[model samples]
Structure formats: structure tokens, C-alpha cells
Target chain A: MFAFFLSSGLFLGWSLGANDASNVFGTAVGSRMVKFRTAAIVCSVFVILGAVISGSGASHTLGKLGSVNAIAGAFMVAFAAAMSVYLMTLARYPVSTSQAIVGAIIGWNLFTGSRIDTNSLTKIVLTWVACPILSAVFAMIIYKLVALYIKFMKIHMFKLDSMTRYGLFFAGALGSYSLGANNIANVMGVFVPVSPFSSISFYGLFTLTSAQQLFLIGSLAIAVGVFTYSKRVMLTVGTGIFQLSPVAAFVCVVAHSIVLLLFASQGLERFLISHNIPPIPLVPVSSSQAIVGAVIGIGLLKGGRGIQWKTVAGITSGWIVTPIIAALISFISLFFLQNVFQQKTYRPVGYLITIDAAQRIRDGGVSEEKFKGLQGREFPTAVKFSNALSEYTELTREERDLIVLSAQMDEMEITRSGITGLDTNWITPEQIAALELLEGRVFDHQWQLDEALAEVSPYWRFREDDDKYNRDLRQKLSYIYRFFRYG
Target chain B: MSKGILRKQIGIEKQIDEFLDLISESGLIFKAGIGAYLNGKTDDFLRKIEQITDAEHRGDSLRRTLEERLYIQTLIPESRGDVLELLENLDSLLDQFKGAIWQFEIERPEIGPEFHEDFKEVVKYAVESVESIILSSRAFFKNIAAVADHMHKVSYWETESDKVSSNLQRAIFRRKDLSMSHRLQLRDFARQVDNIADVAEDVADRLAIYVIKRSL
Candidate 1:
């Protein structure tokens, strides 16, 4: 059953590979500076490495927006997104898989009555807008520098040709790596919450987490797509589109790679945060859009006569239209899958405000009067509960979300089997010891186990000053949350 | 792989340099051949003719080899067409030089004493024009920014050659002592030698456009 459902995500991965691979290697192959065979090999190897190593950062943001909690639901969400991409592309509308997946996830959220995290949504949308603009700026700067160097150095034409070919190969590699690191979330992120695999340890040298395993499978599908179908796309991109000199093509590829790295690199984010600077959000951005922005930058640098404003307008319209189309498809397909096909798309999560839940809400700084009437009332879904909270309380969105989180009812039991199921490669011994202490404890809410674990060991406790450690802790906590809930 | 690519580049660079050297050497040989012909040294003139004919054949062979290597390796793809056109034009300059020398050998034109210095001047100017255009073509391959520095000199020498060729033709036609056939033959030889400079100027014009197309 898991294999059957995961096929949709693999399909999405394949299509992403077939299309987006061209964005990185197209100009190189088009100009005949790099052969398609060499490009396909370098692209496949780096993409796999990037996916397994750095794929988690962007998926974290997607998980924040909405965690599609059922395998069947994840399947339909991925299927709908893939369908939207295919349908829109067939209709000659430019589309982004990133936008399509985000829309499909939101559709799942609406269907499940889960509250959408507006903050995450805003960050994602902002990155989408900033991606192309940043790429254009990088391209212009790199182009000027390269042009000046070539002029002043007085390199031979043949040497410059050789150098540009080398540059294109390296830049294509980097672009493929960034593409996999940033965009794998769109292919495998929806299945992360319901992933059936556990962390696999290899002689204590390394571990592949459940999410990493899913990413590996997804990236392999992408590699297959690159090997099988990307050659035609590459040829078309090389010759059929904008005619760029080899040097300009190299510059554009470097610029595109840099933009994708800025949006997807967790190390950069951590470095910025550690230095007391605000971090750029790790979001999956469109690789095609980045290349277009780069080409436009080169065009504008050459005095703006070469730019086709019509293509720019077409891509801009795609940003707004692709997601809406995907959302409608996702919602409609999910409805049929749940009712007509008799699949369980969601497990209804009931909300209750017990005495302990009220105490937790009070601890979060919400006034007693705000949620007074909402106490002792049970709601069948988050939508009913939020509606009740609004009727009885005058609170801000954050405060209302806090009430919903605090009052959410999730029955968890830290059983012997659950404790044994935890991978020591991921969980520290001290953290596992804490879990062992609460082995038979039953908790009515997920936060109760968190509180218990924090009390027993400082290893599980989050510190305010250490952002990196806290981020890791949050991941472990979420993983533990799902482990105990399902086990 | 990188080492292999560099080896291939070196091989092609050597071939291109060899090709350019042939053109430059032909210009020098053409000037020497014209001097020998005007001095009436039959043996030296014939030797120069053979040397020039050999140079022209070698230049043609080198050009064909270079064009084949470029297509086979797919090097400098964006500029490949331009480079091939430039090579063909440069080869034509060699043909013009060889053709003029052959004309001297065939017609054995009777030159009067007064026209000797004028003939040398026209040949000098035409050879200088070829020299300048050769420099421009080399710059186009090795240092594109320096191409402009040498390109304009081709037209300058061409104009000087035109002046010398016209004065010599007028001097030849003005002489009533020579027959109409003799005057016409001398005039045709002068024009033939001056046409080398004219072709060099046309090549410079094409090189300018190739430079622009290659500019970043």
C-alpha cells in the first residue's frame, strides 16, 4: 500500500527532473560547449548528493505550511499537483512545480480543516517574488566582472572557449545540486509526515532517516528522468530559445545556481543567524524562473533591446494561476478519493479544552477571560473549535492559534515498544533515558510528553540562545511526537 | 578529461598559428618576388615565383586542415562560422599574390626604366597592406581587444597603394614611346598588384563585424 501511494510522488519527481534539468544544462548543451551525456552524468550524481544531504531545510518550511498526515491523502495531493503541472503545460501555460505543490498542500489543509500557518505562507510567497529579482542582480554583476576580466587579460579566443566550457560544466553541476536540494521538497515533502520507514543505521557510521530515505527514492526517479527524457528538452533549450554566447550562458548558469543556494542552504541560514543577522527563509524556488531572470539580466545589460516582455508577462501570470488551478484539482480529487473511492483522506482530530489544557493555555500568556466559554467544550474538528474560539474570545490570530495548539487532543502513550523503536543514532542516550523513564506514562496531549521529557533531561529542553541546537531539538521532538502517536 | 581538452586546444592553437605564419610569410615572399622581377634577375625572379607558389599551396592545405579540425572538435562554436569565413578571405589574398606573380612570369611585361621605382612603390604599399591585415587577423584570434589597433591600418595601406598604382598607371599611359599593348600590360600589372590591398581592406571590414559579434 505504501509503495502504491508513493508512486505519485515518484512521478512528480520524474517530471521535475525531465523539465527542470534543462534549466541548468540547457545553455551549455545548446551552445555545444558541453555534451549532453556528460551533463546528464554530472547532474544525476550531484542531484542525489544534494537531495540526501541538504534536502531537509526547504521541506521544513513546507511541513510548517501543512503536514499531509495520511498516505492516501499525500498520494492524491501529489497526484493532483502533477496533474495540474501536466494540464497547464499542455495548455501552453508556464507552470512551477513548487507553486503547484504548495497549492495542493493548502487544498489538503482546507479539506482537513487544519489551520494554515500564515507566517510560513507569507515567507514562501515572498521568496517566489524575490527569487527572480535576486537572480537578475547576480547575473548582471557576474557578467560585468567576467567581461572585464576577459577584456583585460587578453586571453586567446581558443583559450576563452576552453575556459567557458569548463565554467559551464562546473556551473551546471552546482545548479543541479541546488535544484535537488531546494526542490526535492515539492516531490517528497508531502509524504514526510506519514513516511513508513525508520532511521537506518550503518555500523554506527551514518544514518539515513525516514525522510532521507524518501528523498533518496525521489531523487533517483529524478535521475531516471534526466537520463531518459531531458536530452530533448536540453537540445530545445540550447538552440530553440534565446541565443546566448557561451560566456553569457555560463554567467547566467552561475547566477541561477547562486540564487537557488541562497534560498535553500541551511548552512548559510545558520551562519547568518549565529552572527545575529536575520536568515533568509529556506523555500523551494522555481529553477526555470531563475534562468529566465538571468537571461533577462544579460539582455538588460546589453541595453534591453533583446528582452521579450511578452514572455516575462506570461511567466508572471503563471505564478498566480498555477497554484489556483492545482488547489482546485487537489480539493476536487481529494473529495472523490475520500467518498467515492472510500479512502480515508484524513483522521479527524478532535479538540477539547480540559482543565489541564486550560492551564497550558494560561501558561502561554492567554488570559482566562479570552477562552472562558471555550473551556469544557469539545469540537469535532479544528474549524469548529476555531469558530467557537472566535465567538467566545477576542484574541489575535497568534493567540488564537496558541489556544488551538494548546487545546488540541492527541492521546499518546510512551510504551516499551515506542521506547525501543527510537533510533539511538538520532536520539541521544540521555534523551532516550528520559523517554525510558516515562515508558508507561499516558498523556492526553502531545505537549505533555514534551513537558515530561524536558523535565527529565536538559538534552530535550530548548534553549533560547542556541538557534541551531533548538532547530535540531524541534525536529527530534516532532519525530518523537509522531512516533509515540502512531506506535 | 580536462587535460585531454587542453591537449586538443594546444594542438588546434598550433595549427592556427602555423596557418597565420604562412600568410605573413607569403606577404614577405611576394614583395621579394616583385623586387626580383623589376630588377630583371631572371633566375632570382623564377626562384621567388616557385617559393610563392609553394607558399600558396601550403596556405591552402593549412586552411583546409584548420577548418576540418574546427568542425570535428566543435571548438569555438559561436565564432566558428566567422573564423572559417576569415580563413577563406585570407587565403584569397594569398591567391591574389600568387596570381600576380604568375602573370609576370606569363606575360613577361616590358618595363621601362622610369616605371621601375613606381612599380616597387606600389608593391611595397600592397605588401604593407597585407601585413597590416595579417596582424589584425592574428589579433582577432589571440587578443580580440587589440584587433582594432591593427584593423584600421589595413585601409590606410590600401589607400596608399591606390595612390601609387594610379600614378604609375598614368605614367605608363602617358609614354608615347611604348606601344598601346605594352602600356596596357604595365597598367594591368599595376592594378593587379594593387588589388591585393583592396582585398585586404575588404577582409578587415568583415573582421570588424566578427569582433563585435564576439564581444561580451
Candidate 2:
């Protein structure tokens, strides 16, 4: 059953590999500087390495946007995203899997009546615009420096050819790695909440989290896609688009890779935050758009005569059109999967404004008069609850979202089996001991469990001053919530 | 694998340099052959002919090897065609030098004392033009920016060769004592020597275009 649900995610992974690999190695293969065989091998190996190692950072933002929360729901969301990408490709429009998946998740949110985190949505949409522009700036700078070096040093033509060949190979490898690190979220992120795999320890040497395991499988599917289907796309990108010299191709690839790394590297984010600088949001960005922007950068540097503005406008339009199509497809497909197929597409979460919840909301700065009529009333979905709140109180979207979060009724039981199944290598011994003390206790909501655990042990409490530590704490807390709720 | 590629590249670079050396050396051999013929040193003239012919053969062999390696190894793919064409043109220039010397040996025309200075002057200018073109070809490989510097000088030497060859031909036709066939034969020798510089100028013009194509 797990494999049956995971097939859709794997299909999305395969499509991502088939299309996006060309963005990295297309110019090299098309120029005949690197063989297609060599490019495929290097690309597949590095992509897997990157996905397993650094894929978690971007998925966190996707989770914030909307967690799919059920296996059948994840399947339909991935299927819708993959189908939209295929349809757009068939229609000869520039498409991005990242945008498609975001739209599909939003569709799932609408169907489940879950509140879309506006903060996460705004951050993701802003990055979609910033990504290409950043790549263009990096390309222009690197191209100018390389041109100046060639002019002053005067390298022999053959030696320069050899150097460019090596440069293309390394840049392609880096680009492939960055592509996997940043874009794997679109493939397997929807399934992360309902992943059936548990963390496995290899004799205490290392541990593979369930999310990492999912990413590994998805990346392997991507590798298969690269080997089986990417050659044609690469050839077209290499020769059909603007004719770039090998050096210019190298510059474009390096610039694209840098942009992906900036958006995906957790280590870079940590380093920036530790030094009192604002961290860049980790978001999955479109690799094709980055390539187009890099190419345009070179054209603009050469006095901007060769750019086809019509094609650029067409591609930009596809960004808006592809997402709307994916969202509609996701909404319709999820409806059929739940009703016609008789699948449990989502678990209905009920919201009730209990006295304890009302007190929490009061602490959050909402007045008692705002919820006078809603006291002790139960709503089947978050949308229903928010509508009821709007009828009685004048509240902003953020305040309404906060009330919905406080009233969410997630019944969690700390059982012996759940306690024994915890990954000891991940959850510290002290955190586990705290969980053992609370064995057999019941909590009305996720935050109730969080509060109970924090009261028992400082290890579970979040540090307000440290963002990195708090992020890891939240991840562990989320894992615990799932383990106890569905174990 | 990289070491093997580097070794192959070094071998090709050396062969190209040797090929250019053969052309430059043949130009000197042509000049010496002309001087020996004018001074009536029969034995010396024959030796120079054998030497020029040997250089031309070696240049042909080296060019063939370089061309084969370039195609087989697929090195410098973007500029391979241009480099191969340049090599063939340089080889043709070497053949022109050998052909001119062979003409002198076959025809054995009786030369007057008055024509000696003009013949020597024409040969000097022709050799100078070939030498400048050789430098430009070297720059095309090693230092592309310096190619224009040497390339412009080829036209200058070709113009000087043109001046001397036209004066020598006019001087020969103006001689009333010489037979018409003999005068025409001497004129043919003058044109043959001057043709080497003309070919050098043409090769330089092609090289200039190749440089433009390669510039980023």
C-alpha cells in the first residue's frame, strides 16, 4: 500500500530528472565538449548525493505552506503536479515543477479546508521572481571577469579549449547537485508527513531519517529519468537556443548553480544568522528559468541585440498559467480519489473552542467578546471555524489563523508502543525519559503535548535566542507528534 | 586520462611549430638557391634544391599527422576547421618555395649581370614576407592578440616584393639584346618568386578572419 501511494511521487521525480537535467548539462553535451554518457553518469551520482544530504531545508518551507497529512492525498497532489507538467510540456510551454507542486499543495489545502500559511506563500512567491534576476546578475559579473582574464593572459586556443572542457564538467556537476538539493521538495515533500518508513540506524555509525529515505528513493528515480530520457532535451538546449560559446556556457551554469545553493544551503543560512545577517529563505526554484536568465545576461552584456523578448514574455506567462492548471487538476483529481475511489484522502480535523483553548487565545491578545457565541462549539473543518469567527469578531487573517491553530483538536496518546518505537539516535535520552514519564497521558492538541513535555524537561523547550536550535527542536517535536498520533 | 590528453596536446603543438619551421626554413633555402644560381655556383644551387624539397616533404608529412590527430582526438572542436585550413595554406606556401627553386633548376635560363641585383632584391622581399606570415601563424596559436601585429607586416613585405618584381620585369622586357623567349622566361622567374609573397599575404588575410571568428 505504501508503494502504491509512493508511485505518484516517483513519477514526479522521474519527470523532474528527465527535464531539469538538461538545464545543467545541455550546453556541454550539445557543444560536444562532454559526451552524453559522461554527463548522465556524473549528473545522476551527484544528484543522489545532494538529495540525501541537503534536501530537507527546502521541504520545510513546503511543509509550512500546507502539509498533505494523508498518504492518498499526497498521491493525488503529486499526480496532479506531474500531469500538469506533462500537459504544459506537450503544449510547448515553459513549465516549472516547483510552481506546479506549490499550486497542487494549495489545491489540497483548499479541498481539506486548511488555512494556507500566508507568510510561507508570500516568501515562496517572492523567491520565484528573485531567482532569475539573481542568476542574471551573477552571470554578468562572472562573464566580465572571465573575459578580462582571457584578454590579459592570452592563453593558447587549444589550452583554453581544454580548460573550458574541464570547467564545463565541474560546473555541470555542481549544477546537478544544486538542482537535486533544491528541487527534491517538489517530488517527495508532500509524502513526508505520511511517510511509512522509520529511521534506521547502522550500528550507531549513522542514521537515516524517514524523510531522507524518501528523498533517496525519489532521487534514484530522477537518476533513471536522466539516463533514459534527458539526451534529447539536452541536445535541443545545447544547439537550438541561443548559440553560446563553451566559455559563456560555463559562466551561465556556474551562475545558475550559485543561485540554487544560496536558496538551498542550510549551512549558509546558519552562517548568515550566526553573524547577525538576515538568512535567505530556502525555497525550491525553477532551474529552467535560471538558465534562461543566465543566457539573457550574456546577451545583455553583449549590447542586448540578440535577445528575443517575445519568447521571454511567453515563458513568463507560462509561470502564471501552469500553476492555475495544476491547482484545478489537483482539486478535481483529489475529489474523485476521495469519493469515487473510496480512498481516505484526508483525516477530518475538528476544531472546538474549549475553556483551555479560549484561555490560550486570550493570552494571544484576542478578547473574550470575540468568541462569546463560539464557546464550546465544535466545527468539522478549519474553514468552518474561521467563518464562524469572522461572523462574531473583526479579526485580521493572521489573528484568525492563530485562533484556528489554538482550537485545532488533535487527540494524542502517549503509548508504550509509541515510546518504544522512538528513534533513540535522533531523540536524546533525556527527551525520551521525559516522554516515558508522560506515558499513557492524553493531550487534546499538539501544542498541549508540547507544553506538557516542555514542563517535564528543558531539553524539549525551544530557545528563543537560537533560531537554528529552535528549528531542530520543532522538527523533533513534529516527528514526536506524528509518531504518537499514528503509531 | 588527463595526463594522456596533455601529452597528446604537447605532441601536436610541437608538430605545428616544426611545420612552421619547415616553411620558414624553405623560404631561406629559396633565397640561397636564387643567390647561388645568380653567382654561377652550380653545385651549391643543386644542394639548396634538395634541401628545399626535403623541407617541403617534411612539412607535408607533419601537416598530415597534425590533421589526423586533431580529427581523431576531437581537440579544440570549435576552432578545428579554421586551424586545419590555416595549416594547409601554410603547407601550400612551403610548396610554392620548392616549386620556384625547381623551376630555376629545370629552365636553367642564362641570366645577365644587370638582372642579378633585381632578382636578389625580389627574393629578399619575398622571403621577408613569408617570414612575417610565419610569425603571424605562430601568434594565432600561442598569442592571439599578437597576430594582428605580425599579420599587418605581411602586406607590407608583399607590396615591397611587388615593387621589385614589376621593376625587374619592366627592365627585362626593355632589353633589346635578349631574345623574346629568353626575356619572357626571365620574367616568368620574377613572377614565380613574387608569387610566394602574394600567397603569404593571402594566408595572412585568412588568418585575420579566423582571429575575428575566435574572438569572444
Candidate 3:
């Protein structure tokens, strides 16, 4: 049953591969510089490697924007995104899976009444607009440099041709890797919060966590998409549209891959933050947009005579229409999946106010005096609690949600000491060593200790793969840790 | 794989060169045919004409084959139009050679003692101009920088042919030893031979333009 629910995510991954793979190797294959078979093989292998290894970074941003809590909700969100991409592709318009998935997530947020992180959402939207423009700029610069090199070097015609052929294959491989790393978030991101698999140890060599397993499955679906349906699209992009020179094609692919890598690299983002620079938001951007921008850049550099304006207009309109259609489709599908199919599209969470809850609300910097009249009242959901609290005190949505989430504690007595006292039968020796190292170091949340141990030893993590639970654990642990250390 | 495609294009380019060779070879045969007719060797003149006709036929076949290869293979799509135009213009020079030689064979113009050497000189200059143009066209596919130098020689020979044709026509009209009709026929023959150099110059001019376009 869980596997059946994952089909939608797989479908989305397949559609992503089918459409975006053309952006990577279309020109090379279309120009007859590289064989389609070789391009497809390299793309499939590298894409899977990128998805399994570095697909987590952009997914965190997607998670922040909206957390689809139920498997049914996740299915609908991915399904809506895949359908939008498919329909737009059929219409011969370049569509962005990033835009489709983001819109569908926003629709899910609206349906579930979840608190949307506007800051993260705004950053994601800004990047979507910036991604193509940046690629265009990069391509223009690169194209100019290439032209200068050709003019100055007076390279032999055959040598220039061979060099471009090799450059295209290299750029195509890099593009595939970047695509897998960045866009895998859109494919399997919704499922990240409802992953059904547990960490499975393969003879103690390495543990395949639920998130990694889900990503692996999604990568396979993408590989299937590349092999089966991307050839005709590649041909269209390569020769059917604007006939690109081999060097111009190389410039476009390289520029596109660079933009995707910049957006997807968590290491780069971390480096920037650590250096006190404004970090680049890790987001899935449309590869189609990037490549189109690159081609336009090259065309403009050559005095802009050969560009097909009508096609550009059609593509831009498709970009505008795709997200709205996806959002509408997601909203309608969730309504049916929940009401008609009787599936839990959203798990309504309840909250109860207590002495600990009041303390947490105070800790969250909210005035406890406003909650004095209803200190012991219960609310069926965080939205309900926020609404009731809003009636008494003036509070913004984020602050209200933050207060409710912090105040509404689970009844389970989870603590660092309790984590230490749990059964050690399944714990690895590395986890034991890590725990011993933290004997004197106090942790506030039990799951924080679990995460810290998991960092040291992969075996100590939770069986469930939901990023929301893991994020909640980290957030609560940080708050409690701050309270203990400061006060 | 790219090398393979390039090799195919090179093959087609080589075929074009071969076609140019056939034209130059036909020009030599046409000159020989004119020389035999001037010497009143009717049998040899007829044989040389046959040879010129055969060369023209081969040149025609080769031009057709080159056109089909270019269109079917799409070897140099960006410059195919320019290349086809160059081929057509060059091929017309061969037609001029065949047409002028056949006219000489049919008319059998009276080559007076005074104009025989001059007539042969005109034919020599015309053939030399064509040979220079062929070399220039070959240089186009080999070393573009050398094309200008070869085209310069073609221009030089064409001017010499122009001077000789004018002098020969003036001498023919000024003559009192021949009939007006015969003199008129001789002048016409001189113009036909000089037209070969004129046609070669036209083809060379087109080649220069194509080279410029390709280099850019």
C-alpha cells in the first residue's frame, strides 16, 4: 500500500527526466556531435549518483515552504506537478518542474491550513526568476570568450570541431549531474516528510536511511524516463527549434549546468553563510528556463537576428500558465483524495495548554498574560489555537503558530537521559562511543541526542524518514538547549 | 563521429576540386581543337572537338553528382548556397569552351597568314586565364590566403586576352586582302575565343566573394 502511494512521486520523477534531459544533451545529439545512446547512458548514471548523494539540500528549502503531512497529500502534490509538466510538454512548451512542484506544495498548504513560511517561499520564487537571467548572462560572457578564442587562435576547422564535440559531452554530463541534484527535490521532496522506509543496514557497511532509499527509487524512475521518452524531445530541442552551432550549444549547456549547481550546492551555501556572506537559497530551478536563457544569450551576442520571437512568447506564456494549472489541479485532487477516497490528506493535530505549555509560550517571547484566562483550554489543531489566541492578543501568523507549536508538547517524556537509558541492543559500537563522549554534555530533547548520535553513527537514527519530525526534533532541542544554557 | 562527418564534407569538397580539374582539362582540349583547326588539320580538328565534347560531358556529370552529394549529405549547410552558386558559375565557363570550339569547327573561319599566330596567341591567353582561375578555385578549398594571388594572375591573363582580341579585330576590319563577310566572320571568331577569358574572370570574381563569406 505504501509502495502504491509512492507511484505519484515516481511519476513526477519520470516526467522531470523526460522533459529536462533534453536541456542537457539536446544540441549535441541534434547537431550530430554526440550519439544519443552515449548521452543517455552518461545522463542516467550521473543523474542517479547526484540524486542519491546530494539531493537533500534543496529538499530542505521545499520542506520549509510547506510540509505535506499525509501520504495522500504528498501523492496528490506530486501527481499534480507531473501532470502539469506532461501537459505543457505535450503542447511543446518548455515547462519547469520546479515551478509546478512549488505551486502544488502551496496548494497543499492552503488545503491543509498549514502555516506557510513566506520568507522561504519568497526566496524560492525570486530564484525562479533570477535563475534564467543569470544563465543568460553567463552564456553571453562565455559565448564572447569562445568567439574571441576562435578568432585569435585561428584554430584548424577539424580541431575546432573535435574540441566542441568533446566540450559538449563534458558539459552534458555535468548538466545531468546538476539536474539530478537540484531537481530531485521536486521529484521526491513531498515524500521526504512521509517516507515509509526505515534505515536498513547492509552487512554493517553502510546504512541506507529512508530518505536515501526514497531518493534512490526516485532516481531510478528518472533514469527510466531518460531512456524511454527523452530522445524525441532531445531531437526537437537540438535541431527542430533553432539550429544551434556546436560551440553555441556547448555554451548553453555549460551555463545551464552552472546555474543548477550554484542553486543546489549545500556546501557552497554553508560556506557563504559561514563567511558572513548572504547565502544562496538552495532551490530547484527550471533547467528548461536556464537553457532557453543561454540560447537567447548567444543569439543576442550574435546581434539577435536568428531568434524566434514567437516561440519565446509561447514558452513564456507556458511558464506563467503551468504553475497556476498545477496549483488548481493539486487543490482539486486533494479535495477528492480526502473526501471521496476517505484518505487522510492531512492529520489534524491537537494541542493542550498546561504549566509546561505556559512556560514554553513565555520562552517563545509571547506574553503569557494574554493566555491567563484560557491556560488549561484545549484546541483541536494549531490553526484553532492560533485563531483563539488571536482573538485576545494581536499576533502575526508566524508568531502565533510558533507559540502554539512550542506550547503544544507531546505527553511522551522524552529527554537526553531517557535516550541514554533506552535499550542498546540495536545500537552500534560507534553510537555507544558517541554517547560516552556526550556523558557530561547535556542535551535538552531526546531526539536531539538521537540526531547527534546518528551523526556520529548512522544506526542511532529514527525508523521514520519524515523530515518534519526530524526538523521538529532539532528545533525543540535548540530551544530547550538555549534555555538550559542561558538561564 | 564528428571527424567522420567532416571527412564526408571533405570528400565532397574534393569532388568539387575534381570538377574544376575537368573544366581546366577541357579548356586545354578546346585550345588544342582551335590550334588544329587553324593548321587546317580537319581530321585532327574533328578528333580534338570530340575530345572537348567528351570532357564537357564528364564535367556535366560530375557537376550533377556534386550537387546531389551536397544536397543529400548536407555537408556544409551554412555555405551550401554559396558553394552551389560557385559551381554553377564555374560550370558555365566549361559550357563557353564547348560552345566556342563547336562554333570554330562549324564556321571554319579563314585564318589569314597574318592573323594565324595572333589567333593562336588569343587562344593561349584564354586557356591560361582559365587555368589560373582553376588554381584560384582550388586554393579556395585548400589555403584561402593563396586564393587572392591566384585570382590576380587570372585577372592579368584576362586583360592580355582582351588586348589581343581588340588588336586582332582591328586588323581584320582594316584588311583589304579579304572579303567583308570573311573579315566579319574572323572577328566574330576572335570575340568568341576572348569570351573564354571573360567567363573565367567572372567565375574568379564569384570565387573571391564566396571565400570572403566562408572566412567570416
Candidate 1: residue A415 lDDT (0-100):
81
Docking quality (DockQ) for each candidate: 0.73, 0.55, 0.15
Kindly report which residue stretches of model 3 are placed more than 4 angstroms away from their true locations once superposed. Answer: A28-66, A155-166, A177-243, A262-285, A349-390, A395-487, B1-74, B80-216
Write down the lDDT of every candidate, Cα atoms only: 0.82, 0.83, 0.74
- Each candidate's TM vs. the true structure? 0.91, 0.89, 0.70
Q: What does the lDDT come to for candidate 1?
A: 0.82
Count clashing pairs, candidate 1. Answer: 1
Q: Given the true complex, what DockQ would model 1 score?
A: 0.73
What TM-score against the true chain A does chain A of each candidate get? 0.86, 0.87, 0.74
Q: Which candidate is the best by lDDT?
A: 2
Clashing pairs in 1: A30-A238
> Whose DockQ is greatest here?
1
Query: Which sections of candidate 1 miss by over 4 Å?
Result: A48-66, A87-96, A181-217, A231-241, A271-286
Residue-wise lDDT of candidate 1 within A1-487, one digit each (tens)? 8788889988878877777788899879878888888899999998998899988655443342236767688788888777776664444333467777778888887888876656656755775577778888989999999988988898888988988898888888887887788778778876776689999999999999888999999999989878877776665445444567899889888888788778766688889988989888666556776776777778788887766677567656766777777778889999999999999987677899889889988988988999888788889888889988877867897788788988888888888887777667778898999998988888888788888999999998989867667878888887677667742
Q: What is the lDDT of residue A179 in candidate 1?
A: 75
Model 3 earns a TM-score of: 0.70
Model 1 residue A409 CA deviation (Å) reads 2.3
Per candidate, the number of residue pairs that clash is 1, 0, 0
